[model samples]
Target chain A: DAGVTQSPTHLIKTRGQQVTLRCSPKSGHDTVSWYQQALGQGPQFIFQYYEEEERQRGNFPDRFSGHQFPNYSSELNVNALLLGDSALYLCASSQTGHYGEQYFGPGTRLTVT
Target chain B: DQQVKQNSPSLSVQEGRISILNCDYTNSMFDYFLWYKKYPAEGPTFLISISSIKDKNEDGRFTVFLNKSAKHLSLHIVPSQPGDSAVYFCAASEGGAYNTDKLIFGTGTRLQVFP
Candidate 1:
């Protein structure tokens, strides 16, 4: 069985540009969530998608958004990127009614130049 | 504000020693807590977790203790091995029934176990 997978292992974007990172959740899981891990810090929650609709969000600003397809894959989009946006973007998946522990992907490293 | 904090940035211990990593949270609403370990260039891997209702949870060689009144949690790794050397993180969530349990994580503590 395949675990959660993410695309574009590493990426570089210029300031003011836009970037989209992709994620495929673990098999048999339905919920997808995104997180940002800055240098020397733990990951901060971005948002979560369930049933193709956003269900929960963190303290991030509007520049961050996400989408979940019917197949349970997800995409995280960041617009008007800033240097501070440079970080490791992680994707996590879990079953809706489980104990709430999530399985995570290796993550996409986004470096805003 | 950082709701979760791991004050220790790094720790080193001889092999076979007990390693204790601590975490504190400011949010009382957080009921479910988890510990994760990460190697360079990898995502955080879930280690063990505890719910607010429970004070302790254990797995083979790994245990997590929760102090709800003090808003503190700790991960204990007994007889630590060199392979266990990695960055450890503490995460918390509200654990709602229907909503996704979004985690709030700590800065992380790097552990190095030497033989």
Candidate 2:
């Protein structure tokens, strides 16, 4: 049984440019959420997607958006990235309506230069 | 404001000794608390959880204690091993509240188990 999987283990982006990170939830899971973990900081919730629609979002700005495909996979899009955007982007998955006990992915390390 | 707080930034324990990491929250609305263990450059793995209805929950070598009145919780690891050295984060969720799966996390405490 494969756990949650994320793409592009590591990435480097320039300021003012946009980047996309992908995630495939753990098997038998239907919900996916994104989080940002800055250096020496805990993971902060970004947003959650359920039933192919964004269910809830955190305090993040609109520049941080996400999409959930029918396959229970999700993508996090950060537009016009800034140096502050450099962090580890984590993806977690859980069963619908049962949001707790989310299994996390390895996460993508995004370096915004 | 940090709803969930892990006051200790780091903790060191001798291998085979007990490790008690503490966490406190300001929000009474939090109904569920969880403990996660994370290694370097990797995502946090769920360790143990306790619901507001219960005061304690134990899984294998991990045990979570919740004190509703004090709005505090703690994770106890018995016979700590060197592999247990990592950052431990405390998370709480108001499951039935406004947000969907909004888990407020503490800054985390780095646990070093010395052998």
Candidate 3:
């Protein structure tokens, strides 16, 4: 079974531009969460979505937003990106009620110039 | 403030030896702890986890030990193999607290198993 999958393996954007990244949850999973990992640093939580509604969020700013579709797929959008936004964006999927042990997808590398 | 910390940035161990990676957390609210293995350019893969109620959990050659009193957790890999070399990260969740599934992660420790 394909675990979790993400689109646009790599992207390049200039400062002030916007970008969108996508993710498909694992089979039989209903929750999706996004994370940002800077070079040489561990992933920092972005937000989590369940039932097409945001359930939790991290310390990210308003420019970072996300959407969850009925199928449990997800999208992470960043507006007015800054050079500091360049990082690896990761998507993780988990079944609700499972104590939050998530399975992750190969992240998308975002390069903000 | 960093909630979780993996003080060792890197470690080198001989193959077939036991590799112990350590982690400590400052948050008492975390009730569940997990260990993940990550390769360069790839997302982390869940390895093992232990709840606050349990002190240890073992799977194959991987064993995770949690010391609640010390607010510390560790992953032990016996008979370490070359394939086991990777960056290992420690993650924690608050369980039902705040009714969210947010996880806080540590900076990670790189393990290199030499054959």
How many Å off is the CA of A112 in candidate 3? 0.5
What tens-digit string does per-residue lDDT give for candidate 2 at B24-61? 99999889888889998789998888889999999888
TM-score of chain A of each: 0.98, 0.97, 0.97
Q: For each candidate, report its DockQ versus the true two-chain complex.
A: 0.63, 0.51, 0.54
Interface RMSD of each: 2.3, 3.1, 3.1
Ranking by DockQ: 1, 3, 2
By DockQ, the best candidate is 1
Q: lDDT scores for all predictions? A: 0.93, 0.91, 0.93
lDDT of 3 by residue, A40-63 (tens): 888999999999999989999999
| Candidate 3 residue spans exceeding 4 A from truth | B96-100
Off by over 4 Å in 1: B96-99
Candidate 1 has an interface RMSD (Å) of: 2.3
Lowest lDDT 10-residue stretch of candidate 3 chain B:
B94-103
Q: How good is model 3 by TM-score?
A: 0.97
